[model samples]
Target chain A: MSGAFEIYRRWLRDRRRSTIVWSVSIAAVSVVTAAFFSSLGQSLGENAESGSTTSSMLGLSDGIDPQTPTGFLWAANYSNQLPWLMMALAIALGTAAIAGDEADGTLEYVLSKPVTRSAIAMARAAGMVTILFISAIVNLVAVAITAPLFDLYDSVTITGADGSTSTASGLTFGQLVVGGLAAFAVALGSGAIAYLLGAASGRKGWAMGGASGFAVAGYVLYTLSNVTGDLEFLTWISPWRWFIDDAMMVNGLTWDILWPFALTVVAVVAGWQLFLRRDLQN
Target chain B: MTVIEAQGLTKKWGDFAAVDDLDLAVGEGECYAFLGRNGAGKSTTARMFLDFLRPTSGSVKVLGGSGADPEVRSRIGYLPGDLNLPPTMTGIEAVHYFGSIGHEPDTAKVQALMDRLGLTADRPFHQLSTGSRRKVGLVLAFMNDPDLLILDEPTSGLDPVLQDTFRDMVIEHKQRGATVWLTSHVMSDVDRVADRVGLIDQGKLAQQLSMDELRTKSTGNITLTFPDAPDVSSFDGVEGVSNVQVADRQLSIHVDGPVTAVLARAAELGAVDIQTEKNDLEDIFLDTYSHEAGR
Candidate 1:
C-alpha cells in the first residue's frame, strides 16, 4: 500500500470505536426525535400557528409549515441539534489530525520514515472528513427509516404568499439528499478551520479552542443580525446564515451549500502550505 | 568509505546554540559511539542526520547523499531516545506498520527478535513493559536491515541480558559492514561495542579517539601502601608516573605507560600492599564531562 493510504487506514482503524460511538449516538437521537413527532403532531401544529418561541427557535419562518412531516423533522431535529453534534465531532477530529499526534510524540516518529510530510497531513485530514461523512450518512439513514413509521410521508397542505391555499404530498427523496448535504458542508467547513489551525501551530489546544471560538462567534453574529436591521450584513460571514437563509431541507438545492465546500477546500490548501513551512514540535 | 559526514553543522534556538560548528564522520563497518552529557547536542546532531530538524547552518550527508532524500532514508535505521508509538497498536502491528514505510519486513526475523527479546507480540504497545517497548523499537529499527543505523541511547531501559544481546546484535551488524552511530551517556554500554568514541561537551566535539589510541594515552594506575610514611615523595618525577598523591601511609600513582618503572619504584619504597587498577572508559568519560554543569 502507498504510505499515505497506510497512514489513513491506521487512523481509521485506531478511531473505529470512537467513530462508531459518535455515529450511533447521533443516529439514535435522530430516530427517537422522529418517533416523537407522531405524538407531538397536534401540539406542534398549534405552536406553529400561534408562532411560539419554540417555533421560531426551530427556524420555522415563512413558507415552512410545521404541520408537514418535512418541516417538523427539519425544525425539531436537523436545524439545531444534528448540525451542532456534527460540528463538535468534526472539530474534534480535525484538531487530532496533526496537533494531537504531535503532542503525543507519534507524528515525529512517523515523519522519520521515507514518506513526505504533506502525505501525512493530507491523509489525516481525509480520515477526519471520512468520519464526518459517515456520521451524516448514518443519521440520514436512521431518520429515513423512522420518518415513515411516524406517518411523516403523507400529503400536506400549503399556503402561498397570495393568501391562496393548496394541497401537496410530502417532500421527495431528493430533498433529503440536499438537506444532508447542507449539514455535511457546515460541519466540514468548521472542521477545516480546526485542521488549518492545527497544521499551522501543531498544538491541539490552539486548534480546538480557536475553531470552536470562531464557530461561536459566527453563530452569535448571525443570531444578532436577525434581531436588528443594521447588523444584517454580518450574516454574510456566518455559516448559520448560509444554512438557515435558504432553508435547504424545505427549499431545493441552492448556491449556499457550495459556500462551505469552497471554504473547506481553501482551508485544506492553506493548511497544507502552512504545515509544509513550519518545523515539527519535538 | 565514510557512510556519514557532517561539516560545520550547527543548530540554534534563538541565541542559544544547541550544536555549534560540529564535524563528524563514521566510516563503513565502524561503530562510532557518540558520548556526551545531557543537553550536549547528541540528539540534536542525530536529528539532523535524519532530517528531523534542519541545521541552522552547515550540512550533513548520509549514505553519500543528502539525508532529506527518501532514497537515502530508505537505507538507514533510526531509534529515537524517546520512543512513542500509537497506543492502540500491538507489537506485531507496529512492525508491519513501520515496515510498509521502508520495505517488506522479514517476519521470520521479527519473530526471532521477539523470541530473543522476550516480547509478546499480541499485547498493545501501551500495555507492554518498558523493556518490551524498547524491544519493539529495536525490532522496528533493525527489521529493514538498513546500511546505516543511527540509534540514540539504543539500550536505555533494557535489562542486563538484553543489553548484552543488543551489544551482540551491533557487533553482528558491524561484521556485515553496516555503519552504526549510537549516542550514550553510559560508558559501559558503548565501551564493549564501539570501535571509536567521540566525547561531546557543550555542543562541541571535545575529543575523538580510537580504542587503541585511548588505551595508549590512558594507562593503568597503581597504589602502594607502605608500612610507614617512608619517603612520601619517592615516586615524584618518575618517568612513567604522570600523577601522584601522598596521604597518610598510602601513595596513589597514575601511570601513562607500562607499569615497570612504577613497579620498580614501589619495591624500593618497601610497599606493604600494592594494588593495580586499569584505567576504564568511565574514568575517561567522567574526566571529559565533569567540567560541564548539569544540563
Candidate 2:
C-alpha cells in the first residue's frame, strides 16, 4: 500500500525520542544495579532466600545462589527490574500503535487517504515491533558491555548452607543473550494484550490501564502464590511464573520462553481484525 | 454523473437515530450544502459516506464505488468537522504525509493554498490555533483537487476573510468538475458555495432546495409602526405576508416570498417606521419545517 510504508516510517520516527529515553533509562538502572552488585559482597546469599515478599521482589527462584556471579546478575537486574520496565515500554508502544491515534482522531484522517484499514493496522504493529526491538537491543548492549566490568563474567565459588562448596560458572554471552530475549518476550506479550485492548476498543486509557493492570495482577498472583503455596495451581496463567521459573540468565533457553512469542502472533492478528470491524472514534 | 449517492442511509446507536433514512445524490461539478443544527446528523451522514461509520440499513456510494475501495478513496479529499492530526506533526509534515498517501497532489497548488491561508509549518498541530488547524485542513482538502470533497463545518473556526477565501476555493474546485458536499450553518458561506441545500432536523431531512428555490423562499421579519396602535386584523389575509402581531403602535409581520407586496400593504396602513430582519439558520429551519408540515 502507498501509505503503509510512510505511516510505519513516520510512526517509528515519532517513537524515536521516547524509545531512546525509555531504553537508556531502563538500561541505566540495570547497569547501575550491576555496578553495585559487587558492593553487596556476601549479603547476596542472604537476599536469595525464597518464599517471602522480599524474595519475590528479588525474583529469587529455588536452588539459585545469589552469591554466585550468574545468580547475582539474574537476581539483581535481568529477573525483575529489566523485564518489568521493558514490559512498560512495550505496553506504551502497543497502546499507542492503534488506540492512541484513534482516540485523538488521527486514525480517522489517515483513513481518508487511499490506504486500507488493514494497511494502517499492519503498519502500526510493524512500527511497534521496530521500536521495541531497538529498545531490547540497547538494553542488551548496555548489559553486555558492562557485565565483565562488574565481574558478572567471572566464575565464583559459594559455600553451601551445609558447609560444602561448589564452583559456580560465569555468565556466558549465550546466557546473557537468552536473558535479554526472555525479558523482551515477556514485555512483548504484555504489550500484545495492550495492543489487543486498544484495537478492540479505540480507547487509549482503557488499553493502557487494562494492560498495566494485567501485568501487575499477574506478578502479584505469582508472588502471592509463591509465598502461600496455596494458589500454586493458579500461577500457571501468569507470565511471571514461567519467566521466574527458568530465569534464563541462570538456566539458558527454556521452553517457557515460547509463551510470549505465541501470544504476540495471536494479538497481532486479533487486534488487526478487531480494529477493522470497529468505528473510528472522533 | 453522480459523484456521491446515499440510498436509504441510516445510522442509529441502540434506538437513538443519528441519521435516518436519508436518500441523496450529488452530481459532478455541483456543490451540495448539507444544513443542520448541532446533533442533527450532518457529521454522522458524512462519516457514513466515507466508511468511517457504517450505515445501519442503507448503502452509500462515492464516485460510483464503495468508500472502502482505495481506488475510489484515492480520488477524494475529506476534511472532518474537527480536524485532528498527530499533535507532534507540523503543518509541513501533515501536507507532505497527507499529500502523498492518496493522489499526487499538485505541489504548486499546495504552496499557493498555504500562502493564501497563511498557514505556517513551524508549529505542531496541537500548538496551532483552531483557525490555523482549519487552514491546514483546507490546504489538504484542496491540494489533491480530488473528484469529490466532503467537508463538515469547514468554516466554523475561520475568520470572515478566510471564510470568503474558502468559498472562492470551493467555487474553483466546482469549476474544475469536483463535486463538493459540505455542511455548514453559516448561511453567507453556504449561500456562495451551495448549488443546492438540504435542511435536516433531528436526524431526518426535512427539506432540500436549489439555490434558486431557496432565494425565492428567503423570508424575513418586517416590523412596521403607525402613530397609533394598528389593528392586527387589518393586515389579515395580506398576500406575501404572515404572522402579523400588533403591539402598542407596532405591527410585527413576517414577510415571505416577496417584500414588495407587504411594503405596499404597510404603506396603506399608515406605518411610520419599518425594520427588516434578515433570515438566519433558525428562520430557515422554521420556514422549511413549516413547509414540510404543510405538505
Candidate 3:
C-alpha cells in the first residue's frame, strides 16, 4: 500500500473496536428513531385524511384531518433532529482521532515512521470522516427500512398548511446522501482541530479536553447567535451552524454546499501544518 | 571516511547543559563505545546525531549530510535509549512497520536479526519481558543493515548468552564495514567489543582511551594471606604500590605496576596462598569518573 493508504489502514485497524461499538449503537438508535417517527407520521396522516384537525392528530389541538402525507408528518417532526444527532456523533468520534494516540504513547512510534507528520494528521482525520460517513449511511438505511413499515410508504402524499404538497416522491435520496457526505466533511474539520491540539499538547487528555471545550463553545456561540441580535457573527464561526444550515436532506444539493467542504479542507490543512511543526515529546 | 561527525556539539535544557561542546568522529567499520554514568548525556548526544533533538549551537553530520536530512537518516540505524514500541503490534508487525518507513519490506533481514537474537515474531510487544523487549529493539536497530548503527545501552536487558550472540552480530556487521556506536554500563561489554572508549562524566568527556592502553594503565590488586601476620610495613614504600592493608592474617595491596616486586615482597613475608588479580575495567571506570568529578 502507498503511504497514505497504509496510514489509513493502520487507523482503521486501531479504531476497529470503536467502529464496531459506534456502528451497533447507531443502528440501534436509528431503528428506534425511525420506528417512533414513522408511527407518529402515519397517525398524523390518517387523521388528516379523515378530515380531522391536524393539531389534534399531532396532540396539539382538538379535531384534526387525517389526510396529511406521512412524508410531511415525518419531515415536520423529525427533520430538525437529524442535525443535532449527527453533530453529537461527529464530535465524539472525530475528536479522538489524534488525541487517543497521544494519550496512549503511540504518537512517537507513528512519528518515527517515514510518513510526514502532516500526512499522519490528515490520514487520521480522513479515517474519522470515513467512519462517520459509514455511520450516516447505516442510519439512513435504518430509516428507509422502518419508514415503510408504518404505512409511511412511497405512495403517501399530504398537503402542508401552506398548500404545498409533500410526498416520499419529493424525498430525494440522492440529496440525503450528499447531505450525509457534507456532515462527514464537517466532522473531518472537527477531527483536524482535535488532531492539531493533540499534536501540540502531546497529551491525549489535553487534546480531548480542548476538543470537547471547543465543541461546547461552538454550540454555545451558535445558540447565542440565534437568540441575540448582537454576537451574530458567532454563528458563522461555529461549525454546528455550518452543519445545520447546510443540511439539505430532502432538498436537492446546491453549489453553495461547497462552503462547508471548503472550510473542512482549510481546517485540515491548518491542523496538518500545526502538527508538522510541533515537537512530539513522546 | 568518517560516517558520523559532530563538532562543538552542545544541547541545553534551560540552565542544564545535557551535552556540552562535544566532538566525536566514527570512521567506517569502527565500533565506538560511549561510557558514562546515568544522565551523563549519552542518549542526548545520540538524539542530536539522529536530529531527534536540535542542538543548541552546534552541528552534526551523518553519512556526509546534515543530521536532519532524510537521506542521512536513510543510511543510519538508530536505537533510542527509551525505545518504546506500540503495545498492540507484534514483533514482526512492528519491525514491518519500521521497514515500511524505510521504504522497503525486508522481512528477511528482520527475521534474520530476530533469529540471531532469539526474538519471537508472534509475541506482542507488551507481552514480552524486559530482556525480550531489548532484544526486539536490537533486532530493529540492526535489521536494516544501514551503513551506520547508533545504539544506546544496546545490551541492557540481554542475557549473557544473547549478549555474546549480539556481540558476534556486531562483529559481523563491522566485518561488512558498518560503523557501530553504542553505549553501555557493562564495562566488560565495552572492554570486550569496543576498539576505543570515550568516558564521559557530568556531560563532559573525561577520557578517551584504547582498550590495550586502558588495560595497561589501570591499577592491579594483590591479596596475600600469611600463616602468621608478618610485618607488612616493609612493603609500604615499595615501588608501584599505592595502598596496603593488613588484616589479622591477610594482606591486600593496590599496586599499579609489575606484580614481580609485590610477589618478591610477599615471599619475604613468608606469605602463603598468594593471589594476584589485575584491575578490570570496573576499577578503572570508577577511578576515572571519580577523578574526573573531583577535577
Error of 1 at B245 (Å): 4.1
Evaluated at residue B254, the lDDT of candidate 2 is 82
**Estimated TM-score for each candidate:** 0.92, 0.91, 0.81
lDDT of 1 by residue, B1-295 (tens): 8998999999999999989999998999999999888889999899889777888999999999977677788888889898899999999999899788768688899898888888888989889888888898888888888899989999989988999899989898999999999998667778889999998888899999998888877778788899987565688877887667888888888888777777888888788898889878888888787766444
Which TM-score value belongs to model 1? 0.92
Arrange candidates by TM-score, highest first: which order?
A: 1, 2, 3
- C-alpha RMSD of candidate 3: 5.8
**Candidate 2 or 3, higher lDDT?**
2
Higher-ranked by lDDT: 1 or 3: 1
Ranking of predictions according to lDDT: 2, 1, 3
Candidate 2 - CAPRI tier?
medium
What lDDT does candidate 1 reach at residue A138? 86
Give lDDT tens digits, candidate 3, residues B89-172: 788887777776666647677777788788787888889898888887787777778788888888888899998888888888
User: B185 in model 2: Cα distance from truth in Å?
Assistant: 2.1
lDDT of 1: 0.84
Chain A only: list TM-scores of all candidates: 0.91, 0.95, 0.72
